[model samples]
Target: MEALGQAITSWVLEGHIVEVPGLGNIRAEVRAKAKSDASDVSADDIFRHHLLLTPTKEIKNALNSTPINITCFDKDGNEVNRD
Candidate 1:
């Protein structure tokens, strides 16, 4: 899990597209904060970074049609499952 998380973070930060198996692509993008036509814009006035996730059609369909299960470890190191 740690390795996968690190890979996703590194790829996204480098503005590279990453395709996760059974999922879609993950990418980074930058956008202007303001939608004005004025030419008075500075670095601080822009939204520098954003992570975008485009999930695959199969994932989307499964998400809509099937029950999802989420498992996590509790503070006491006990496994918990959520639906």
Candidate 2:
């Protein structure tokens, strides 16, 4: 996480992204741009945020490029299947 933070900081400071070869590029953007909006009920209003990431074509293609195996268990250690 620290590495990601540093990379993002650099990106923000540099105003451009730098590809780290194997890892990918360090990108910094609003992510979800901050804004202001209110809900009628005043329950959940997400108007402020950061800009979204617009990864390079290559980077975007790599997203979810790797497959992983996930497993979860209950209190008794019994496997829990999504199905």
Candidate 3:
């Protein structure tokens, strides 16, 4: 697990999309401000960095087909609701 995580991190850092079988593709992204002049743009213009994950069709289908059950309880330990 640790090795897999390291590989994913390394690939993303290298500007490559890393695909996990049966899961999704993960990539690093950055959000930057637009500058009026090209020369005015710099690394400082970048304000946000994030990771994006695009789930595989199989994963999405499985999530969509799965049923979720929920049960709520009161502080008194009594059942309040169920879904």
Candidate that scores best on lDDT: 3
Candidate 1 residues 16-62, lDDT tens each?
Answer: 89999888999987787774666777777776777788999998898
- lDDT, each prediction: 0.85, 0.60, 0.95
Better of 1 and 2 by lDDT: 1
Per-model clash counts, in order, read 0, 12, 0
Task: Write the residue-wise lDDT of candidate 2 on 1-83 in tens digits.
Answer: 89977777767676776666555555544333334653343424344434345566776667768566788889999999643
TM-score per candidate: 0.58, 0.38, 0.71
Please give the lDDT score for candidate 2: 0.60
TM-score top scorer? 3
Candidate 3 at 60: error in angstroms? Answer: 2.3
RMSD, candidate 1, Å:
7.1
Alpha carbon lDDT at 72, candidate 2 = 85
Arrange candidates by lDDT, highest first: which order?
3, 1, 2
TM-score ranking, high to low? 3, 1, 2
User: Over all chains combined, what TM-score does candidate 1 have?
Assistant: 0.58
